[model samples]
Target: MNAPPDIATEAADHVRIVLVGTQHPGNIGSAARALKTMGLRRLVLVAPQKFPHADADAMAAGADDVLASALRVDTLAEAVADCRLVLGCTARSRRVQLRELRPRDAAAMAHAEAVAGGEVALVFGRERTGLDNAELQLCHAAVHIPANPDYSSLNLAAAVQVLSYELRLALLGAGGEMPVHAAALPAGAVPHAALEGFFAQLADTLEAIDFHKGRAPASAMRKLRRLFVRTGLDEKEIRLLRGILADAQRMARLARDAGRA
Candidate 1:
């Protein structure tokens, strides 16, 4: 009989590496190679400029299996819709107020989420400008790789390789046991899509109640998003919050009708 698979490899199977707006097919291929080398199998591509190109296949080399199974989606949200934990790998911090984690810390967090039976995603952005503020909003946290400040421009594949290597090390260090903090995490955390739905409802409710009062809602919404995401809400908590929002909307509508009367 074949030997059983190791705990680390099993957990890795639940993690997906997401690339957004990649401009080069060769980089995708090289990224695939890097993932395969680190024992990670799943790859998600979001709005790549070119795929199914000879350059990608050529660069993949012996990592054809990883390339062949790569999933292509139109948007980053769609790519990570079902994921319970999404970490964006960025070279530097942006305006978004997400918790920052080093590569090793990120790897450990991702590994813990995966081991707890949740889908995890490590998102990478475009080659030139990196992930935009809107894109960063979808992520629960940011992973920063500290490089020389004078020359911090890292290739997309190189960034992927660094995270992949750290993740592999994290998995190996697990020693076949769940991390202590993993047990404290809420079980059955809602996926990204569900949380997004809540945010949409929240915006609508705010509008109904005139919370913004002719001012731009962008700043308020950004702060609200940071507050809620930091709490790591579960499915039950999301449902409760949505229920409150629905009631608020109804009350606001009634108030408007009374004023008209």
Candidate 2:
């Protein structure tokens, strides 16, 4: 009968997003801004078209922190790894039997799951086509925004705003302590610049190995960056990954030296 709260009931009630195959950087940026407005800090990007763009940051404006702290992964499987309940967004009803909810109902369900100490997630598909069967199977439920059936093509960011607004309402209503900005993050989160450098190095390595399924190197780099951005990696995780990268580089150098001999 009543609306959902605006902010998280507790820190654990975080309303995280998993954007799968997003094609636009601006949409990602706008979505980040929307999440920030609703006080939801966690984001998980999965195989986006482009990321770590000046455009995304520029669009985020005051929500730059969200852009800086996003978590990215190449696959939806990895993005939802920690989530106990994954809800995918759909614009159309399906012929197959599946659990689906309107945006309000989905928000209410996700909030209850969060309060129960469950790791919940909301998954969004590409701007053009929604999730394929492979992607949807990963979700326990699907959410459909109740728009006019005559015109159902909602822009990706608009859909994000709709869901985020409902969550903000729900969290603000349930009543909770003030936000914990400083202590909430895992200790020693990676700074933005360092992560950018890591992306460059990672891109170089991936290019050498041709790991992007025939996508051009430039396009691959963009996708990889989106994936990394959503991980929300801390300093320790970054350092560990960088060390791995360094080792690979070292091995390649040794091979080159021996070949030169």
Candidate 3:
């Protein structure tokens, strides 16, 4: 039996496949083709190394429509600016300490969100390195395909195919029923851009307060980013945090002035 009409419609409309810093144009085209096979239409490209090449068109085969409608942006944050549920597809080893789910589990979560009228993004990183720690922090969770342990390498397009196939199954209610964690979702989640703005202010505030008393502070900032992202702050919460940061910045400046006097 086919998927319910509503399920199929939500699957195509609410979910988007985002490729970040793609190195090859052909992979973009091939990934588009993969989504087409599973009735997924939305595709977003973030700062691809090469695009609009004839090779990409050739690789797309008959899925020209998917490529034609693909949205191109300068960064992964921009690509998924409005999506409420973002999942980063990563192949990093067990040492990486993010919430990891298999492709099917990830797809089921994404499917449930989409069905609940939330925008969802499935983010795939560069072909060579996958997502860096900073990029992974932007997503709510990490998706790891459970390939063979000894030879776990999978191509970019192939990874897309695996996730897309599982997503299709989830939407169709195939392979039994998928659980929906509706109660855990945010009540009024803000856009990705809002979180980014807060991060910028936070960095400035920390700098003014001399929070990172060291030669280099990149590592500290990375950990802080992960800490805040894990909270899944909504718009009101973000505003509250920013207000606090602004006050901290003002107090820091006052203290500096007092020391000068």
For TM-score, the strongest prediction is 1
lDDT of each: 0.88, 0.70, 0.83
Worst 10 residues of 3 by lDDT: 179-188
**Model 1 stretches with alpha carbons more than 4 Å out:** 1-5, 174-188
Q: Which ten residues in a row have the lowest lDDT in candidate 1?
A: 179-188
lDDT string, candidate 3, 80-147, tens digits: 88887888899864534566777877877787778778789999999988888768867777888889
Instruction: Write one digit per residue (lDDT tens) for candidate 2, span 87-138.
Output: 7888654532346676766666666656656577888999888888667655
Model 1 root mean square deviation, Cα atoms: 3.0
Q: Order candidates by lDDT, high to low.
A: 1, 3, 2
Query: In angstroms, how far off is 77's CA in candidate 2?
Result: 1.0
Worst 10 residues of 2 by lDDT: 180-189
Residue 249 shift from truth in candidate 3, angstroms: 1.1
Model 3: residue 17 alpha-carbon error in angstroms: 0.9
- Residue 93 miss distance in model 3 (angstroms): 5.3
